[model samples]
Target chain A: MQLRFLRVIFICLMSVAGMVSAAADLEINTPAITALKNSMQQRHNQLAPYYVSGAVGLTRDGQIVLRDANAVPLPQRQAVNALVGAENQDRSALYREIARANQHPEWESEIRSTFAGRWIEKAQPGWWVQDSQGGWKKK
Target chain B: MTKKSCIALAALLLAACVTINIYFPAAAAEKAADKIIDEVWQLKDGEAAGGKGDTGSTDDRPATKPGATK
Candidate 1:
Protein backbone atom coordinates (compact mmCIF):
# COMPACT_ATOMS: atom_id res chain seq x y z
CA MET A 1 0.00 0.00 0.00
CA GLN A 2 1.03 3.61 -0.51
CA LEU A 3 0.77 4.15 3.27
CA ARG A 4 3.14 1.29 3.96
CA PHE A 5 5.66 2.67 1.48
CA LEU A 6 5.46 6.10 3.11
CA ARG A 7 6.09 4.57 6.53
CA VAL A 8 9.22 2.86 5.30
CA ILE A 9 10.51 6.13 3.87
CA PHE A 10 9.80 7.90 7.13
CA ILE A 11 11.76 5.40 9.19
CA CYS A 12 14.71 5.56 6.84
CA LEU A 13 14.84 9.33 7.07
CA MET A 14 14.77 9.18 10.86
CA SER A 15 17.62 6.71 10.93
CA VAL A 16 19.70 9.05 8.78
CA ALA A 17 18.98 11.90 11.16
CA GLY A 18 20.11 9.78 14.09
CA MET A 19 23.47 9.13 12.43
CA VAL A 20 23.97 12.80 11.62
CA SER A 21 23.28 13.75 15.22
CA ALA A 22 25.94 11.32 16.34
CA ALA A 23 28.57 12.97 14.19
CA ALA A 24 27.85 16.55 15.17
CA ASP A 25 30.75 18.48 16.75
CA LEU A 26 30.75 19.38 20.44
CA GLU A 27 31.91 22.78 21.70
CA ILE A 28 31.85 24.42 25.11
CA ASN A 29 33.44 27.82 25.45
CA THR A 30 33.37 30.17 28.43
CA PRO A 31 35.65 32.59 30.23
CA ALA A 32 36.91 29.88 32.58
CA ILE A 33 37.31 27.42 29.76
CA THR A 34 39.16 30.05 27.75
CA ALA A 35 41.53 30.51 30.68
CA LEU A 36 42.14 26.80 30.97
CA LYS A 37 42.88 26.50 27.25
CA ASN A 38 45.21 29.46 27.37
CA SER A 39 47.14 28.07 30.31
CA MET A 40 47.46 24.70 28.64
CA GLN A 41 48.62 26.37 25.43
CA GLN A 42 51.27 28.31 27.27
CA ARG A 43 52.51 25.15 28.95
CA HIS A 44 52.93 23.44 25.59
CA ASN A 45 56.08 25.45 24.98
CA GLN A 46 57.73 23.68 27.89
CA LEU A 47 56.24 20.29 27.07
CA ALA A 48 56.99 20.29 23.35
CA PRO A 49 60.70 19.47 23.54
CA TYR A 50 60.07 16.64 25.98
CA TYR A 51 57.55 15.10 23.63
CA VAL A 52 60.04 15.40 20.78
CA SER A 53 62.87 13.92 22.83
CA GLY A 54 60.71 10.86 23.65
CA ALA A 55 60.28 11.52 27.38
CA VAL A 56 56.47 11.37 27.24
CA GLY A 57 53.79 9.92 25.05
CA LEU A 58 50.02 10.35 24.65
CA THR A 59 47.91 7.50 26.01
CA ARG A 60 44.75 5.84 24.71
CA ASP A 61 42.54 7.12 27.56
CA GLY A 62 43.36 10.78 27.00
CA GLN A 63 46.28 11.03 29.42
CA ILE A 64 50.05 11.07 29.23
CA VAL A 65 52.57 8.44 30.29
CA LEU A 66 56.31 8.73 30.72
CA ARG A 67 57.41 6.86 27.62
CA ASP A 68 61.14 6.98 28.25
CA ALA A 69 62.24 8.50 31.51
CA ASN A 70 65.88 8.63 30.45
CA ALA A 71 64.96 11.10 27.77
CA VAL A 72 64.78 13.68 30.54
CA PRO A 73 68.05 14.61 32.20
CA LEU A 74 68.38 13.02 35.67
CA PRO A 75 67.85 16.31 37.51
CA GLN A 76 65.10 17.47 35.12
CA ARG A 77 62.89 14.41 35.53
CA GLN A 78 61.19 15.86 38.59
CA ALA A 79 60.48 19.11 36.79
CA VAL A 80 59.06 17.20 33.84
CA ASN A 81 56.74 15.24 36.08
CA ALA A 82 55.55 18.43 37.73
CA LEU A 83 54.86 19.91 34.34
CA VAL A 84 52.93 16.86 33.13
CA GLY A 85 50.99 16.76 36.36
CA ALA A 86 49.90 20.36 35.93
CA GLU A 87 49.07 19.95 32.27
CA ASN A 88 46.95 16.90 32.98
CA GLN A 89 45.09 18.76 35.69
CA ASP A 90 44.03 21.41 33.23
CA ARG A 91 43.25 18.86 30.54
CA SER A 92 40.97 16.97 32.89
CA ALA A 93 39.14 20.14 33.80
CA LEU A 94 38.80 21.01 30.15
CA TYR A 95 37.17 17.66 29.39
CA ARG A 96 34.83 17.98 32.36
CA GLU A 97 33.86 21.50 31.42
CA ILE A 98 33.08 20.39 27.89
CA ALA A 99 30.82 17.58 29.06
CA ARG A 100 29.14 19.82 31.61
CA ALA A 101 28.73 22.57 29.07
CA ASN A 102 26.92 20.15 26.80
CA GLN A 103 24.51 19.43 29.68
CA HIS A 104 25.45 15.76 29.55
CA PRO A 105 28.06 14.81 32.11
CA GLU A 106 27.39 11.26 30.96
CA TRP A 107 29.06 12.19 27.70
CA GLU A 108 32.41 12.85 29.44
CA SER A 109 33.77 9.36 28.94
CA GLU A 110 32.67 9.34 25.32
CA ILE A 111 34.25 12.75 24.83
CA ARG A 112 37.52 11.57 26.44
CA SER A 113 37.62 8.45 24.29
CA THR A 114 37.09 10.52 21.21
CA PHE A 115 39.94 12.84 22.27
CA ALA A 116 42.09 9.82 23.04
CA GLY A 117 41.83 8.83 19.40
CA ARG A 118 42.22 12.34 18.02
CA TRP A 119 45.28 13.11 20.12
CA ILE A 120 47.03 10.09 18.67
CA GLU A 121 45.65 10.69 15.21
CA LYS A 122 46.97 14.24 15.17
CA ALA A 123 50.36 13.43 16.62
CA GLN A 124 53.43 14.43 14.62
CA PRO A 125 55.61 11.75 13.07
CA GLY A 126 57.96 10.13 15.64
CA TRP A 127 55.93 11.28 18.62
CA TRP A 128 54.74 8.27 20.64
CA VAL A 129 51.00 7.61 20.79
CA GLN A 130 48.96 4.75 22.12
CA ASP A 131 46.85 2.77 19.71
CA SER A 132 43.25 1.68 20.17
CA GLN A 133 44.58 -1.63 21.41
CA GLY A 134 46.77 0.17 24.01
CA GLY A 135 50.10 -0.23 22.22
CA TRP A 136 52.31 2.82 22.11
CA LYS A 137 53.80 3.42 18.68
CA LYS A 138 55.59 6.26 17.03
CA LYS A 139 53.36 8.22 14.69
CA MET B 1 -3.28 -12.43 4.73
CA THR B 2 -2.01 -12.74 1.18
CA LYS B 3 1.52 -14.11 0.53
CA LYS B 4 2.91 -10.60 -0.16
CA SER B 5 1.32 -9.28 3.03
CA CYS B 6 2.74 -12.20 5.04
CA ILE B 7 6.22 -11.51 3.67
CA ALA B 8 5.92 -7.84 4.55
CA LEU B 9 4.75 -8.77 8.03
CA ALA B 10 7.72 -11.06 8.50
CA ALA B 11 10.12 -8.32 7.42
CA LEU B 12 8.51 -5.91 9.82
CA LEU B 13 8.85 -8.40 12.65
CA LEU B 14 12.55 -8.82 11.99
CA ALA B 15 13.03 -5.08 11.98
CA ALA B 16 11.10 -4.57 15.22
CA CYS B 17 12.85 -7.27 17.22
CA VAL B 18 14.48 -6.11 20.45
CA THR B 19 18.22 -6.20 21.22
CA ILE B 20 20.42 -4.57 23.75
CA ASN B 21 22.46 -1.72 22.31
CA ILE B 22 24.54 0.69 24.38
CA TYR B 23 24.13 3.50 21.95
CA PHE B 24 27.63 4.94 21.38
CA PRO B 25 27.31 7.98 19.17
CA ALA B 26 30.72 7.18 17.64
CA ALA B 27 30.23 9.61 14.80
CA ALA B 28 29.22 12.41 17.15
CA ALA B 29 31.91 11.48 19.65
CA GLU B 30 34.58 11.61 16.94
CA LYS B 31 33.42 14.99 15.69
CA ALA B 32 33.33 16.43 19.18
CA ALA B 33 36.71 14.90 19.96
CA ASP B 34 38.35 16.30 16.85
CA LYS B 35 37.00 19.79 17.43
CA ILE B 36 38.31 19.88 21.00
CA ILE B 37 41.60 18.29 20.07
CA ASP B 38 42.13 20.79 17.27
CA GLU B 39 41.34 23.65 19.60
CA VAL B 40 43.59 22.43 22.42
CA TRP B 41 46.39 21.63 20.04
CA GLN B 42 45.23 24.26 17.55
CA LEU B 43 48.55 26.11 17.47
CA LYS B 44 49.79 26.18 13.87
CA ASP B 45 53.27 26.94 15.22
CA GLY B 46 53.85 23.15 15.21
CA GLU B 47 53.84 21.98 18.80
CA ALA B 48 53.50 18.26 19.63
CA ALA B 49 51.56 19.07 22.77
CA GLY B 50 48.73 16.53 22.74
CA GLY B 51 48.95 15.20 26.29
CA LYS B 52 48.30 17.83 29.00
CA GLY B 53 44.67 18.02 30.14
CA ASP B 54 43.58 15.99 33.20
CA THR B 55 40.39 16.81 35.14
CA GLY B 56 39.48 13.59 36.95
CA SER B 57 39.80 9.90 36.51
CA THR B 58 37.22 7.68 34.98
CA ASP B 59 40.28 5.42 34.90
CA ASP B 60 37.72 2.82 34.14
CA ARG B 61 37.19 3.11 30.42
CA PRO B 62 33.52 2.90 29.64
CA ALA B 63 32.64 -0.58 28.43
CA THR B 64 33.35 -1.33 24.80
CA LYS B 65 30.18 -1.71 22.76
CA PRO B 66 29.53 -5.39 22.20
CA GLY B 67 29.56 -6.68 18.66
CA ALA B 68 26.21 -6.93 16.91
CA THR B 69 24.96 -10.49 16.73
CA LYS B 70 21.92 -12.65 17.38
Candidate 2:
Protein backbone atom coordinates (compact mmCIF):
# COMPACT_ATOMS: atom_id res chain seq x y z
CA MET A 1 0.00 0.00 0.00
CA GLN A 2 2.89 2.37 0.78
CA LEU A 3 4.47 1.38 -2.52
CA ARG A 4 1.27 2.34 -4.28
CA PHE A 5 1.33 5.73 -2.54
CA LEU A 6 5.02 6.19 -3.48
CA ARG A 7 4.22 5.36 -7.11
CA VAL A 8 1.41 7.91 -7.15
CA ILE A 9 3.68 10.58 -5.59
CA PHE A 10 6.42 9.90 -8.15
CA ILE A 11 4.01 10.14 -11.04
CA CYS A 12 2.59 13.40 -9.71
CA LEU A 13 6.07 14.87 -9.24
CA MET A 14 7.11 13.89 -12.78
CA SER A 15 3.97 15.36 -14.29
CA VAL A 16 4.50 18.61 -12.38
CA ALA A 17 8.12 18.72 -13.53
CA GLY A 18 7.11 18.24 -17.14
CA MET A 19 4.57 21.06 -16.94
CA VAL A 20 7.12 23.40 -15.33
CA SER A 21 9.64 22.68 -18.04
CA ALA A 22 7.14 23.32 -20.78
CA ALA A 23 6.03 26.57 -19.20
CA ALA A 24 9.64 27.73 -18.86
CA ASP A 25 10.31 26.92 -22.51
CA LEU A 26 7.35 29.03 -23.61
CA GLU A 27 8.15 31.97 -21.33
CA ILE A 28 7.92 35.42 -22.83
CA ASN A 29 8.55 38.60 -20.82
CA THR A 30 5.19 40.25 -21.32
CA PRO A 31 5.94 43.41 -19.36
CA ALA A 32 9.23 44.01 -21.10
CA ILE A 33 7.55 43.56 -24.47
CA THR A 34 4.76 45.93 -23.45
CA ALA A 35 7.23 48.57 -22.33
CA LEU A 36 9.06 48.26 -25.62
CA LYS A 37 5.78 48.60 -27.50
CA ASN A 38 4.87 51.74 -25.57
CA SER A 39 8.25 53.23 -26.30
CA MET A 40 7.77 52.52 -29.98
CA GLN A 41 4.37 54.18 -29.93
CA GLN A 42 5.76 57.29 -28.29
CA ARG A 43 8.58 57.47 -30.76
CA HIS A 44 6.18 57.04 -33.68
CA ASN A 45 3.95 59.84 -32.44
CA GLN A 46 6.93 62.12 -32.15
CA LEU A 47 8.41 61.24 -35.52
CA ALA A 48 5.26 60.99 -37.61
CA PRO A 49 4.20 63.93 -39.76
CA TYR A 50 0.97 65.78 -39.03
CA TYR A 51 -0.09 66.23 -42.65
CA VAL A 52 1.79 63.53 -44.50
CA SER A 53 1.16 59.80 -44.13
CA GLY A 54 3.94 57.46 -42.99
CA ALA A 55 4.79 54.40 -40.95
CA VAL A 56 7.60 53.64 -38.47
CA GLY A 57 8.89 50.27 -37.33
CA LEU A 58 11.31 49.11 -34.65
CA THR A 59 13.47 46.05 -34.10
CA ARG A 60 12.76 43.38 -31.50
CA ASP A 61 15.36 44.94 -29.23
CA GLY A 62 13.49 48.25 -28.99
CA GLN A 63 15.52 49.90 -31.69
CA ILE A 64 14.14 52.11 -34.47
CA VAL A 65 14.03 49.81 -37.45
CA LEU A 66 12.34 51.22 -40.50
CA ARG A 67 10.59 54.39 -41.72
CA ASP A 68 8.53 54.76 -44.89
CA ALA A 69 7.47 58.21 -46.15
CA ASN A 70 6.00 59.38 -49.43
CA ALA A 71 5.44 62.78 -51.03
CA VAL A 72 2.00 63.05 -52.62
CA PRO A 73 1.91 64.87 -55.90
CA LEU A 74 1.17 68.53 -55.23
CA PRO A 75 -0.39 71.03 -57.57
CA GLN A 76 1.37 74.00 -56.09
CA ARG A 77 5.06 74.41 -56.85
CA GLN A 78 5.85 75.77 -53.41
CA ALA A 79 4.03 72.91 -51.76
CA VAL A 80 5.89 70.40 -53.93
CA ASN A 81 9.29 71.90 -53.09
CA ALA A 82 8.38 72.09 -49.43
CA LEU A 83 7.28 68.48 -49.46
CA VAL A 84 10.58 67.41 -51.03
CA GLY A 85 12.59 69.29 -48.46
CA ALA A 86 10.52 67.91 -45.61
CA GLU A 87 10.98 64.37 -46.90
CA ASN A 88 14.76 64.64 -46.82
CA GLN A 89 14.81 66.31 -43.43
CA ASP A 90 12.37 63.87 -41.87
CA ARG A 91 14.32 60.88 -43.15
CA SER A 92 17.49 62.23 -41.58
CA ALA A 93 15.68 62.96 -38.33
CA LEU A 94 14.30 59.43 -38.24
CA TYR A 95 17.82 58.03 -38.40
CA ARG A 96 18.97 60.42 -35.72
CA GLU A 97 16.01 59.67 -33.46
CA ILE A 98 16.54 55.89 -33.65
CA ALA A 99 20.24 56.24 -32.97
CA ARG A 100 19.54 58.48 -30.03
CA ALA A 101 16.87 56.23 -28.52
CA ASN A 102 18.98 53.05 -28.67
CA GLN A 103 22.39 54.72 -28.36
CA HIS A 104 23.45 52.35 -31.14
CA PRO A 105 24.03 54.03 -34.46
CA GLU A 106 25.42 50.87 -36.05
CA TRP A 107 22.11 49.07 -35.60
CA GLU A 108 20.11 51.86 -37.27
CA SER A 109 20.02 50.43 -40.77
CA GLU A 110 19.56 46.86 -39.55
CA ILE A 111 16.76 47.85 -37.22
CA ARG A 112 15.15 49.97 -39.89
CA SER A 113 15.18 47.13 -42.39
CA THR A 114 13.78 44.70 -39.83
CA PHE A 115 10.92 47.01 -38.94
CA ALA A 116 10.34 47.97 -42.55
CA GLY A 117 10.09 44.35 -43.60
CA ARG A 118 7.65 43.61 -40.80
CA TRP A 119 5.52 46.66 -41.50
CA ILE A 120 5.33 45.74 -45.14
CA GLU A 121 4.43 42.18 -44.31
CA LYS A 122 1.66 43.24 -41.96
CA ALA A 123 0.29 46.18 -43.95
CA GLN A 124 -3.46 46.04 -44.62
CA PRO A 125 -5.06 45.92 -48.02
CA GLY A 126 -4.89 49.17 -50.08
CA TRP A 127 -1.93 50.30 -47.94
CA TRP A 128 1.38 50.90 -49.73
CA VAL A 129 4.87 49.85 -48.67
CA GLN A 130 8.29 49.16 -50.14
CA ASP A 131 9.91 45.79 -50.75
CA SER A 132 13.39 44.52 -49.91
CA GLN A 133 14.79 45.43 -53.31
CA GLY A 134 13.49 49.03 -52.99
CA GLY A 135 10.53 48.22 -55.18
CA TRP A 136 6.99 49.32 -54.41
CA LYS A 137 4.22 46.80 -53.63
CA LYS A 138 0.62 46.96 -52.53
CA LYS A 139 -0.40 45.31 -49.31
CA MET B 1 16.03 11.80 -21.99
CA THR B 2 18.95 13.71 -20.55
CA LYS B 3 18.54 17.43 -19.87
CA LYS B 4 21.12 18.20 -22.54
CA SER B 5 19.22 16.14 -25.09
CA CYS B 6 15.98 17.89 -24.18
CA ILE B 7 17.64 21.27 -24.67
CA ALA B 8 19.01 20.16 -28.02
CA LEU B 9 15.56 19.06 -29.12
CA ALA B 10 14.07 22.39 -28.08
CA ALA B 11 16.72 24.31 -30.02
CA LEU B 12 16.06 22.19 -33.09
CA LEU B 13 12.35 22.89 -32.84
CA LEU B 14 12.97 26.60 -32.54
CA ALA B 15 15.24 26.58 -35.55
CA ALA B 16 12.67 24.74 -37.60
CA CYS B 17 9.97 27.25 -36.64
CA VAL B 18 12.03 30.30 -37.68
CA THR B 19 10.58 32.09 -40.68
CA ILE B 20 11.46 35.43 -42.31
CA ASN B 21 9.88 37.11 -45.31
CA ILE B 22 9.17 40.62 -46.69
CA TYR B 23 5.63 41.82 -47.49
CA PHE B 24 4.53 45.31 -48.61
CA PRO B 25 2.03 46.63 -51.13
CA ALA B 26 3.59 48.39 -54.15
CA ALA B 27 0.74 50.86 -54.73
CA ALA B 28 -0.09 51.19 -51.06
CA ALA B 29 3.56 51.62 -50.17
CA GLU B 30 3.90 54.47 -52.64
CA LYS B 31 0.81 56.14 -51.27
CA ALA B 32 1.99 55.66 -47.70
CA ALA B 33 5.36 57.09 -48.51
CA ASP B 34 3.79 60.04 -50.21
CA LYS B 35 1.41 60.66 -47.33
CA ILE B 36 4.26 60.51 -44.81
CA ILE B 37 6.23 63.10 -46.71
CA ASP B 38 3.22 65.36 -46.99
CA GLU B 39 2.39 65.07 -43.31
CA VAL B 40 5.94 65.81 -42.28
CA TRP B 41 6.02 68.90 -44.43
CA GLN B 42 2.79 70.15 -42.90
CA LEU B 43 3.96 69.51 -39.38
CA LYS B 44 7.42 71.03 -39.79
CA ASP B 45 5.90 74.33 -40.90
CA GLY B 46 2.19 74.86 -40.65
CA GLU B 47 1.15 75.37 -44.25
CA ALA B 48 -1.09 73.67 -46.76
CA ALA B 49 0.60 72.65 -49.99
CA GLY B 50 -1.94 71.54 -52.51
CA GLY B 51 -0.93 68.58 -54.64
CA LYS B 52 -2.46 66.17 -57.06
CA GLY B 53 -4.46 63.81 -54.90
CA ASP B 54 -3.33 60.14 -54.94
CA THR B 55 -6.83 59.06 -55.99
CA GLY B 56 -6.48 59.68 -59.72
CA SER B 57 -3.35 58.54 -61.54
CA THR B 58 -4.21 59.98 -64.91
CA ASP B 59 -0.62 60.82 -65.90
CA ASP B 60 0.78 57.34 -65.17
CA ARG B 61 4.15 58.99 -64.60
CA PRO B 62 6.47 56.71 -62.70
CA ALA B 63 7.98 57.70 -59.34
CA THR B 64 11.47 59.20 -59.54
CA LYS B 65 13.01 57.40 -56.57
CA PRO B 66 14.61 54.00 -57.03
CA GLY B 67 12.70 52.82 -53.99
CA ALA B 68 9.47 53.76 -55.74
CA THR B 69 10.25 51.39 -58.63
CA LYS B 70 7.06 49.44 -59.33
Off by over 4 Å in 2: A1-74, A77-81, B1-70
lDDT of 2 by residue, A1-139 (tens): 5555455555555655654443232121244432333343334344444222433332232222234433432344354344445444444445345434433456445544443554454444554455555554445
Q: lDDT by residue for model 1 over A1-139, one digit each (tens)?
A: 7576657656755665654553364555576667887787678778888888878999998888778998888999999999889988887887788777756677778777777778888888888888878887887
Candidate 1 regions exceeding 4 Å error are A1-25, B1-25, B43-70
Against the correct fold, how does model 2 do in TM-score?
Answer: 0.30
Q: What value of lDDT does candidate 2 attain over all alpha carbons?
A: 0.39
TM-score of each: 0.62, 0.30
Interface RMSD of each: 5.7, 13.1
Count clashing pairs, candidate 1.
11
lDDT per residue for candidate 1 within B1-70, as digits (tens), equals 4556655854664453311113445676676666556656653322333445643322343455688455
Q: Which candidate comes out best when scored by lDDT?
A: 1
Error of 1 at A1 (Å): 31
